[model samples]
Target: TLPVLAEPRAAQDLGDWLRELQAFNLSAREHAHTPLSDIQRWGGQAGQRLFDSILVFENFPLEDALASAGRSGLRFETQGSTGLTEYEMDVEVSLRQTLRLSFTYMRRAFDAEQVAAICAQMMALLGAMGTSPAQTVGSLSLLGPDEQAALLALGQG
Candidate 1:
């Protein structure tokens, strides 16, 4: 897993944030063969956890791989969950013909409603970033028009 510390500043635009990520990925590729243990040792935090959340991108064609595994007359299916998570939250992105995203979170830390809202906000932010890459990150709206109007009404009350 490639470790990426992506904290977009309020003044930074989406394009700037993306560029930073691209640069970091390129640099990380240079040391892609390095073991995670070695990296942790170098950072002087061998036993420490660096992050609580992880993002996994599945770019390979799983079906094709399974078909090529020489298992004739046998079918393979993807498991949805193993009833376990290594991190507080896990975001999985499957880069198929249609992009798919799945989020798994610890029940103790977040409720389903909260996760749903987070998903909505994330989609909104992604849409905004795609449409207006030059817009400042802080200027992006996480709330929909109805939600914004409701918040304004509550504030007035």
Candidate 2:
């Protein structure tokens, strides 16, 4: 069975997790979209607040690579998040020899096996990063899967 963190079983911890989830989204989006050079220009942060908590596997963009492929061409994309940050990914398919083709995608690959491997790896890293139930600080119940999903999206899960 997939290992799961039981809900915090405390209201205060859940509340803290919620707030952290929100902040995580804001920071993640800012980090994901801004290019490395621009990030260098901005002192490494855009000073935005995190938004949502849920990490709905989603898409971002395939502008640069797809544009190189030209219009009316095939393009594949995928999306995922660490417990702290969200990401958009594209698959690069290439043929090395007449009978050999290979694919490399860093985000959530359209390929199921790749996706599973990366997701598991990401979740493990998230755990290593100390992103479990946070201090709640209020009267509330334990955070649910819904909240946990959000927390995971923040690159904090």
lDDT of 1: 0.79
Per-model C-alpha lDDT, please? Answer: 0.79, 0.43
Candidate number achieving the greatest lDDT relative to the actual structure: 1
lDDT of 1 by residue, 1-157 (tens): 6566678898987788889988988898888888767777888979887777877777796766898774776777778784335888888878777878789999887899998998888777677777878888888899866677989999999
What lDDT does candidate 2 reach at residue 28? Answer: 72
Q: How many pairs collide in each candidate, listed in order?
A: 0, 16
Kindly list the per-residue Cα lDDT of model 2 for residues 66-88, writing each as its tens digit. Answer: 66666657665646634332333
Worst 10 residues of 2 by lDDT: 93-102
lDDT of 1 at 5: 69
